[model samples]
Each structure stands twice: as structure tokens, then as C-alpha cells.
Target: MIKVLLNGCSGKMGEVVVNASKNFPNIEIVAGIDKFPTEKYNFKVFKNTSDVDIYYDVLIDFSRPEALVDLLNFSVKNNKPIILCSTGYSDEDLKLIKEKSNIIPIFKSANMSLGINLINSLLKKIVPNLYENYDIEIIEKHHNQKVDSPSGTAILLADTIKNSLPIESKYVFGRDGFSKREKNEIGIHAVRGGSIVGEHDIIFAGSGEIIELSHTALSREVFAVGALKAAEYMADMFYPRIYNMEDLLGI
Candidate 1:
């Protein structure tokens, strides 16, 4: 069995992952790391990642950004593969993750659903060719408690689309007073309400035609399942490399 350590086990997504692990017979979660130790689940919870003693084959993190450095440090020190499912990492934090990949196998994704990663790859191919004629916009929605605005996934989509263009593209998060959409701008909008799991839509508007691509996540288990698959894949792989859902899915 692939021993697993779950970070942020008390959080919403973490709880989902905990339950989802039961479906994978080859994966077992031996321990969990969380700031709050409320007795909602059956797993032994550690207040910090350093307190865990059992040999974990891989560490899956769905925690907050504030706790990422400590988690990354612990994973690197123990030489365990890490799958970072957490969102809202700053550019510097990403740089740190990239640097640490040299020492351990690191898998990071803003969104873990295989479909989303496929969409990202598709956008990379379609965006550049349609740049001159198409106007692009991205809108995403998540649970009300999500801390990040526009979301890391939205930025990932935007960045992928931007990379396809020869000229630099601008990101417009919101419109305030007197501001109009620029010709080279990629509009990104975020919606937070209710108990929605997640939703992302990309709109390509042109002369008389409109193309819309969307993905809706009904449950968090999709992400959990993907993360578990990533953990199993990384267990036997060599370290010092960064991977995403696409790499895990082999697409």
C-alpha cells in the first residue's frame, strides 16, 4: 500500500480527500496535519507536520498558503514526495516550490481535475491562432469560504492563453470607474456565493460567433481522486522534478 500523509485534514477539501482515499485500495492515509484538531474524522491529527513519525510514502497538501512553507520544509527534510493541492500561492512561494523540486518530487496544481488540465492544454493550442479575431474572458466561481479571488486556476488558464500570444496580454480582474476593456486584455472574473464546489468558463467572442468552454465540479471528490492518483504515481518516481495533473494523467 502507498502510505499517505494528508495535510489540512480538517479543512473541507481535506475531509473530502480523507473519505475519498477509501476508494483506492492501494493508498492508505496514515496521518493528518492540521491546525485545528476537531474530532470530525477517525484519523489521528497532528497540530503540525513535524509531529508525524510514521513513514509516509507521499504527502498531499490541501492546506492554506500560510502553512505551506512549513509543510514544504517538512516534506523536503524527510525526502517524501509532495503533491501540493493548495491554492493561493504567491509568486515567491512558487519559486520556492520550484527550487525545492531539485531535492524532492513535487506535484502542484491549482486545480486537480483531469478535465481542467486538459482544457488548459487545449487553450494553449487554440488561443494564439484566434488572438487577432477573438476576445477572451475567464470567469470562475468557488465556495463562499475560498480565500483567493479569481483563483489560481483562473490565473493558470489566463497565463496559458497569454503564453500563446506573441504580444504581451493584460489581465483585467475587475472594472472600477471609467475603465473600458483594452484590446489586448484577458478579462478574469470571480464569483463567490452559496456552497458551490467550483465552476470555470472561458468565453471567446468574435464578430458574429461566440465560443464557450466550461467545466463544472459538483463535488470535491474529483480533486481528491486526482490527488490520490498523483500520490500513487509519484511514490515510485525519482525526485527533483515538478509535475501537474497533466503529467499525472499522462496527457
Candidate 2:
């Protein structure tokens, strides 16, 4: 079995992973690191990653942005590969992760769902052909308790579409004042409501016609399963580099 250390052990996603991982025959969660450590699972939980004394082949994180620095430090010092699934990282945090990749392999994604990653790949192909003639806009909705605005996944989708353009395209988060939509601006909007798992919609509006690409995440298991797959893939990666769901999916 591929022994794994799950971070954010007490969080909602962590609980989901704990329950979902049982079906995977080759993976076992040996320990967990959480700010609020509890005897909540069969394995031990530590408030700090450094305090963990058990053995684990890989690390999987679905925690907050605040835990990132310590996690990176511990992982690199111990030479453990990690799949980072947390969102809401600042620019400097991302820079630090990229730099650390030279010493320890890291698999990171804003969203872990395979459907979203597949949509990311499709946007690369879809953006180039229609961006010039179409005005792009994205609408994303999530549970009310989610901390970040215009979620990391929304940014990922927007960036994927923006990067596909030959020229620099501006990202407009939301519209308040009545202003004409610029040709080069891509609008991103976020909605927070009750009990919604995840929803993303991208519209390409032209003079006469409109096209929309959308995806809805109905359950948390999809992400848990994908993260487990990523964990297995990253378990044996000795090379120091960053990997993503696209790499695992070969898209």
C-alpha cells in the first residue's frame, strides 16, 4: 500500500477523503496534520506536521493557505512528494512553491475534480478560435461558507482562457458601474449561496450567437477520488518538479 499523510485532517474535505480512501486498495492514510488535531480518525493526528513520528510515503493537502509555508518546509526537509489541493494562495506563495519544486516534487491544483481539469484543457483549444469575436464571461457558485471570492478554480479557468489569447487580455472580476464591455476584457463573477457544491459556467458571446461551456460538481467524492489518484501518482515521483491533474490525466 502507498502510505499517505493527509493534512487538514479535521476539515470537511479531509473527512471526505478519510471516508472515500477506504475503497482504494493500494492507498492508506498513515497520519494527519491539522491545526485542530483530534483523535477523530483511526490514525494519529498532529497539530504540527513536524510532530508526526509515523511513516508516510506521500503528503496530501486540502487545507487553508496559512498552512502552506510550514507544509512546504516539512515536505522538502523530509523529501516527501505532496499533492497540494488547497486554494487561496497569494502570488508570493505560488512563487515559493515553484522554487521549492526544484528540491521536492509537488503536485498542485486549484481544483482537484477531473471534470474541471478536462474543461481547462478544452478552454485552451476553445479560446483561440472564438475569443476574438466573442466576449467571454464566467460565473461560478459555491457554498456560502467558502472563504475566497472568485474562487481559485474560477481564476484557473479564467487564466486558462486568458493565456490562450495571443495578446494580453484583461480580467474583470465583477461589474458594478454601468460601463461598456471592452473587447479584450474577460468578466469573472462569483456567487455564494446555500449548500451548493460547485458550479462553473463560461459563456462566449458573439454578435448573433452564444456558446456556453459549463460543469457542475454534485458530490465531494469526485475530488477525493482524484486527489487519491494524484497521491498515488506522486508517491513514487523522485524528480523535483510541479505536477497537475492534467499531467495525471495526460490531457
Candidate 3:
């Protein structure tokens, strides 16, 4: 059995992962770290990672950005592989994750859905060719409780497209008044309401036609399942590197 350390085990995604892991016979969550610890679903929870005594083969974190830095540090100190499913990390935090991957395997992704990764790969291949003719726009929606705007997944999509372009593309988060899109600008719009799980749509518009790619997540369990698969995959690999769900899916 693969022993797992679950970080942010009290949050929404954390709870989903905890419940899902219980049904899998090959994996076990040995310990959990969460800020708000209340007995839920008969799982033992601690307020910090230091309280856990068992050696974990992999650490899965679904916490906030504030909690992620300490979690990454602890994972590095313990020399344990980490599957970071959390979103809202700043550029500096992302740089740190890349730096830490030299010593320990770090699998990170903004969107854990396999389909979204596939979409990202497709975008990378298509964006360069369509750069001149197509005007790009990304619109994302999440639950009202999400603190960050535009969502990390949206940023990832925009960045991938931007990297593919010959010239650097400017990102316009929102527009007001009589503002018109620049030729080299990628527009990103964010919407928050209700309990929506997640949604992302990318549009490429031209003179007479429009091409669109979209992904809608009906449940958060898809992310949980993907993260578990990543943990299992990481346990079997020896190389230390940063990876995304696309690498896991071999797209």
C-alpha cells in the first residue's frame, strides 16, 4: 500500500480526496494537516504537518497559497514527493516549486482534469498558427468562495498561448467603456456565483467564423482522482522533476 499525507484535509477538495481514498484499496491516507480541525468522516486531523509521525511516500496538498509555502518546505525537508493540486500560487511561489523539483518530484497543475490538460496541449499546438488571424479570449467561472480572480487555469491557458506566439501577448483581464482589444492582446474574464464547480472557455474569433474550446467540471472529484493517480505514479518514478497532468496522461 502507498502511504499518503493529505494536506488541507479539512477544506472542500481535501474532504473529497479523503473520502475517495478510503474506497481505493491500494492507497491509504495515513495523516492529514489542516488549519480547521474538526472530526469529520472519522478521519484524524492535525493542525500542522509536524504532528504527523508516519513516513509518507507522497504528500498531496489542496490548501491555500498561504499554507502552500510551509507545506512545500516540509515536503522538501522530508524528501517526499508532492502532488500540488492547489491553485492561486503567485509567480514567486511557482518559481520555488520549480526550484524544489530538482531534489524531489513535484507534480503541479492548475487544473487537474485530464481533459483540460489535453485541451492545453492542443492550444499550444494551434495557437502559434492562428496567432495572426484569430483574436483570443478566455472566460472562466468558479464558485463564489474562490478568492482569486481569472482562476489559475485561465492563467495557465493564457500563458501557454502567449508562449506560443512569436511576439509577447498582452493579457487584458477585463474591459470597460470604449476599450477595444489590441492585436497582440489576450482577453481573460472571470465570473463567480453560486456553487459552480468550474468552467473555462476559450474563443478564437476571425472575420466570418469563430472556433471555441471549452471544459466544464461538474464535480471536484475528478481533480481528487487525478491527484491520487499522480501520487501513485510519483511513488513508482525515481526522477525528480516538475510535471503536469498532461505528462501523466502522455498527451
Candidate 4:
């Protein structure tokens, strides 16, 4: 079994990952690092990565941005692969992550759901066909407890669609005041509600017709399963590099 050090193993998504691990027999969470460690996991928990000395094949970080620095340090010191599944990072944070990728193999993706990534690739082809004739807007809904608005996945989707367009496009977040929709803009709107696992809708409005491409996640298992797959993939890799869902999917 590939031993994994699970970071942020006490939070909601962390709990989901723990529960979903049973389905992946090849991966085993040997340890966890969380601020609030609990006995719920069969493996031992550490308050910080620095304190742990276990032999883990990979480190799967679903923790907050604050924990990133320590996790990278731990990864570098141990020469281990890391699967980053966290969202909400600043430009500086991303730069730091990129720098750290030179030291260890890092797999990072805004959305770990394979369906979302497949849609991302599909949109690369789909956007070019429709961007000129239609106005596009994305609506993403998640649970209220989730931080970060206009989710990382929303940005990822928006960027994916923009890169595919022939002409330059601008991104517009939730608009409240009446402003005319511009032709060169893609609007992304986020909604927070009760216990919504995840939902994304890409709507294209044309002269007299409409088309919508959507994905709804009923459970967090999608992300958990994807992350586990990534960890196993990374553990087998020996080189220092950055990876994503596209790499994992060979797309």
C-alpha cells in the first residue's frame, strides 16, 4: 500500500476523504496533520508536519493556505510527492508553490473532480465554437461553510473557457448594479446555500436560443477519489515537477 500523510484530516472535506479512503485499497493514510487532531482516524495524528517522523509515500494536503509553507518544507525535507487539493491561493502563494515544485513532485488542481476536469478540456473545444456568437455566464453553488467566493473551480473554468476563445476575454464577477453586458466578457457568479455539495452551470445565450452545460456533485467522494488517485500517481513519479488533473488524465 502507498502510505499517505493526510493534511487537514479533521475538517469537513478531510472527513470525507477519510471516509472515502476505504474504497481505494492501494492507498493508506498513515498519518494526519491537523490543528484539531481527533481519534476518529485509525492512524495517528500530528498537530504539525514537523513533528511527524513516519515513512509516508506521499503527502495529500487539503489544508488551508496557512499550512502550505510547513507542508512544502516537510515535503522537501522528506523528498516526498505532494498532492495539493486546497483552494483559495494568492498570486504570491502560487509563486511559492511553483518554486517549491522544483524540490518535489507537486500535483495541484483547483478542482479534483475528474468530471470537472473533463469538462474543462471539453470547454477548451466548446468555447471557441460559441464565444463569438453567444454571451457566457457561469453559476457555481456550494455549501455555505465553504470560504472563498466565485470558487477556485469557477476561476479555473472561466480561465479554461477564456484561453480557448479566439479573442481576448474579460472576467466579471457577480454584478448587482445594472451594467450592460459586454461582448468580450465572461461572467462568473457564485451562490452559497445549505449543504450543497457542489454545482456549476455554464450558460451561453445567443440571439434567440440558450444552451447550458452543467455538472452537479451530490457527494464529496468525487474529490476524495480523485485526490487519492493523484497521490498514487505522484508516489510512482521520481522527478520534481508540477502536475494537475490534466496530467493525471493524460489530457
Clashes of each: 0, 0, 0, 0
Assess the local accuracy of residue 86 in candidate 1 as a C-alpha lDDT between 0 and 100: 86
Q: Write the per-residue lDDT of candidate 4 for residues 157-246, one digit (tens) a residue.
A: 999998898898899998878888899999999999999999999999999999998999989999999999998789888798899999
Q: lDDT for model 1, on a 0 to 1 scale?
A: 0.89
Q: Model 3 over residues 1-251: C-alpha lDDT tens digits?
A: 99888888888899899888867789998888888886875657888877777777998998888877788789878888899888888889989888888988899999888878899999989998888899999999999999999899999999999988999779998898897678999999999999999999999999899999999999999888889988888876668899888889877
Decoy 3 TM-score against native: 0.95
Best by lDDT: 2
- Provide the TM-score for each candidate, comma-separated: 0.96, 0.98, 0.95, 0.97
**Model 1 stretches with alpha carbons more than 4 Å out:** none
The 10-residue segment of model 2 with minimum total lDDT is 47-56
- Candidate 2, position 127, lDDT: 91
CA lDDT for candidate 2: 0.93
**Alpha-carbon deviation at 132 in model 4, angstroms:** 0.8
Candidate 1: 10-residue stretch with minimal lDDT:
37-46
Model 4: residues >4 Å from true position, as ranges? none
Model 4 per-residue lDDT at 188: 97
| Model 4 error, position 216 (Å) | 0.6
Runs of candidate 2 with Cα error greater than 4 angstroms are: none
Which rank order by lDDT, best down to worst? 2, 4, 1, 3
**lDDT of each prediction vs. the true structure?**
0.89, 0.93, 0.88, 0.91
